[model samples]
Target: MERKHELNNKKVLVVGLAKSGFAAAKVLVKYGANVIVNDMKELEKNQEAKELINQGVEVHCGSHPLSLLDKPIDFIVKNPGIPYTNPLIDAALEKEIPVFTEVELVSYLTDAEIIGITGSNGKTTTTTLVGLMMENNPKKPIVAGNIGTVLCEVADQTDVDDILVAELSSFQLMGVQSFKPHIGVLLNIFDAHLDYHGTREAYGKAKARLFMNQTEEDFCIFNADDQEVIALVENMKSKKVPFSTKQTLPKGACLNEGFVTFNDERIIAIDEIVLPGEHSLENILAATAAAKIAGADTNQIINVLKTFSGVEHRLQYVDTVEGVKFYNDSKATNILATQKAISAFNQPLILLAGGLDRGNDFDDLIPYLINTKALITFGETAPKLIKTAKEAGIKVIEHVDNVEKAVPVAYECSVSGDVVLLSPACASWDQYPSFEQRGDMFIEAVHKLR
Candidate 1:
């Protein structure tokens, strides 16, 4: 890429050895940087480390020794998940060395305009919609970042005419220094990842980084209804485009007379949209704003909104067993997300909820549990959720061992017309390694009932 000169002969330490780290290390090596990789996993368990070692890069596994900082290191490329509170990271900061996530490398690797999407919820859905909307455009779309693919890898192969549609996490955005998106979309912000961020303010600041480097020429698509989003974008340099479901906006994407409109031009009738929920409507408006700004026509936007159901694990509809429809919303890793999922359906819900206890209560979720027929709780937060269920007057609350166990319990409590929803209002780290695994287990258990 374009910024290879900045990395050539520089000593770059790549912390953490996951997909992002591996991709970062390889890119650093390709740019002629002296790369040193570190991870907590043992060397034998880290196949990526071994492969990198063969590429003339230094590999350090099993520990992040403070001594790694003793050398004259130029900078660090850290995995997004590794918090700044990490001892090595803290030490590096004290020494005035720059630290970054692999996301920072995206700006250096490609000239393609990037459309970055971030929020506490609905990020994946909006990013997916924008990617689909841009499919027929003259500029190709390379979807990457937190949606799974390493962004730098996609950036390396991207041409100047391409567009990078990325679903970014707050963690990934926090490490970016000069990264800027041509079109930045913030769906909504909520209390999330407090354990890593230490406070809601820090989390919002990280999400705001998506537009930090954008100029007045760029566009920032944000939620007009969310006060937190409005407050955060109050002083951004980019041209602000607000989308809302609560009120009609005169100049941005909004609902006008039961239709989705951008700048007062109708795109599609809301009733014809395939995705369910008011939250999905918010995503559609945000995506519509970004897609239209990036040269997508009304027909291109309507095509995806009509056919796209949703990304997997975010209110994804699973198979129907015995007339009981199941939905996998395991990606609902916070109170607001689960609240939105619960509000999506009028069908009596056999809600499956619980996961990592992030020092938050479910009291806020009580108001939305009015129609829930039963609550199946699991993971570290089971007791807390059970308490919330009882307070909500949910009489049929059952505490199960895990998601798979909860599936059968949910089905057992359900009759023909009830909806079984696996929308845990917490992170999946307490039992399953990821939310996708938990969702897969729930899907497998639902299949077993057949």
Candidate 2:
């Protein structure tokens, strides 16, 4: 496949100076595209912007005027974080110039076999698992997009035979037009990113696009268990290979008689895989289905599944002191994900909760919180969570300041045979740089208490 946006001395506008933005800017410059990069902040003080300027890419920080788009430019490559509602993007759209995303930009640069995975939940795990499954299989895959590295960086080092297991988010998916993967996996859909998507249906449509452009010759994997994903696949024009953990699927992968069977050819007992909760098991099942369709052998896929120690901050066991286990599930940014973390354990818990509220429905989490000893809440959404839990007849203690205050209280409350879980059913933008940072700070606080 020929590379898209060959650059080759064309003018390009790269918006937003995030990890993806910087990576995109570097590539645009390298390909001889006259790059004018912009961010909402000034470049002189911004580390990433300063680095890009040092590399000689034209920098426009603080703000990008609409008049800049009035001039002739080949195209605009947008960062996923910047919404389509932005005036700059609207102007570019009105001009009839092509607007692409970092994912689209990188997809065009490489001839590598791409595996695009998207969903409201379980996407990161699916992305990493697929990469690990292929690591020893001579593919030597690169996991990029929303997971580890940015797409531009991955594209810089990629070749055709090499696969890119990209964990694409809704933000990345929205601007995609010509981006089609060799294998596209939609794990499961739930209410997430509602603030950006504005509606559940809109978010689902973004996820569905993963397979929208896929041809009959390409592999599109669906989760039969998730009705949203299944319904979308049913209506999709693309040929789909489906997977289900709950029951047998006639076409792709299924669970039958206590064994996971893929294409009715290979079977593995659920006990053979070491992933912790039912959610992880489902993730593995989805990944196995996609991997098998991608020409990976069952035994090799099963071997990797048994060895993979789930992703960090997704039900990661932090430490245990005095019989009280500490589990860091800070990646639980929605009520559904939080409930999964809570349900995985039967023991009484002291849940350290709260973060940036994303219009979460707290009712689903009430039953689990009622089972918990008491709730220790913190951050931006703490007050709302406190009210919701109390309204539902669950005892919750609100500590609406920071993780520093919440951790020790949770530690003090936890006793023998209890688990302390930091599963904030909200975004981490309130107090940390990322979810990993939130989880790390919680771990550090636990150590101090210990």
Candidate 3:
């Protein structure tokens, strides 16, 4: 791929004033692109907005009116937080204006190698792991996208030989037109972000598009354990390479007899991955598959795999006080994720669960609760969760509206050898700014109990 010399003098509308939005605006401005930014709040109220203004970027804070995008524009760069169905985006489309995500925009301008990764869970972990493995290749890879800074900012400062390991979300994948990668890693897919995508099928379609744009020269490393992803290979026309924890793949990576095997000649024992649980094992398999396909040395891959620490907020251990173990799994924003956390624990659990509901099915979680000694529900989803648990013949206790009330009740109910886990199976809009904030509050409340 060849790099473009300049992106100057083109009008680019950057929507959403979040972290990704700020990074996109900064990168576009640096490239001499005419960048117009918009957010649904005042500049003084939104920190990112104020920062962009200080950088001399023109911003329309407090709403994206039709007039904002009605003018002539080269392309519209959007943040993942803004849904595809937004009226402003729709209006831009009606006028034949092109809309690209920050990821797509970055891909268009860089000659750097890209390793795109997407899944319902462990995308951050896998993205970070891939970056670590590539560090041995002498490229000194940069991990970005949904995990940290936007990809364009990383590319702006990167040389032609550098590698980009991107953690792409379902929303980010939607705006991409032809953002193909040299190595594409598809981790296990589960029900997540249904509200933005509208349905499970729609969400899965967006994720599947990551591989749809790839060619035979590129590699699509998939999770064989996920039926949804594997099914896409059977129907799609792209180059398909599958990996799994449950079965062996003929081309990609898989677990066989307690070993992580991938490519055609590379193999490692399950212990080589050295992650926390079985789910993390799957993440390692997917990452190893992508790295091996990209020509990473087997020894370098194993060394990086063993040394990488897991990402925060996903099954994070808070503290152990007087034989009670507490975990902060605020990243489990869906029912299937909470189910995975429950399977990882063997002892009786005092599970603290709830948040802004996304119409999640509670039936899958009832068996885990029945095995537990006590269940405490909080957040706006508490009543709905309690009702569903009761229908499944499980007993649940309700607390006040937030984690502050629920954490103490869980602490009181926990006994020696019992675990108190906060793995809300819904979004955090009810009482927090983001999942990170929710996880922080849960950790702080647990500390207060100590």
Q: Give the TM-score comparing model 1 with the true structure, all chains together.
A: 0.98
**CA RMSD per model (angstroms):** 1.1, 1.8, 2.3
Candidate 1: where are CA atoms >4 Å away? Answer: none
Among the numbered candidates, top lDDT falls to 1
Error of 3 at 375 (Å): 1.4
Q: Rank the candidates by TM-score, best first.
A: 1, 2, 3
Worst 10 residues of 1 by lDDT: 1-10
lDDT of 2 by residue, 1-450 (tens): 746457778898898877888888888788778888889887667898898878887778888788788678888888888887789988888888888788887656888888889887888888888887776666768888888688768877888778888899888888788888988888888888877888889998988888777877888788877788888777666668888877777668877777778878655787777777777777877788777767676677878877786788888887898899989898898888888888888888888889986666577787766568778898888878888778766664657477767887887777889999889998899788899899888888888876
Backbone clashes under 3 angstroms, per model = 0, 0, 0
lDDT of 3 at 127: 90
Cα RMSD for predicted model 2? 1.8
Q: Which stretches of candidate 2 lie over 4 Å from their true place?
A: 235-237, 396-400
TM-score: model 3 vs. ground truth: 0.92
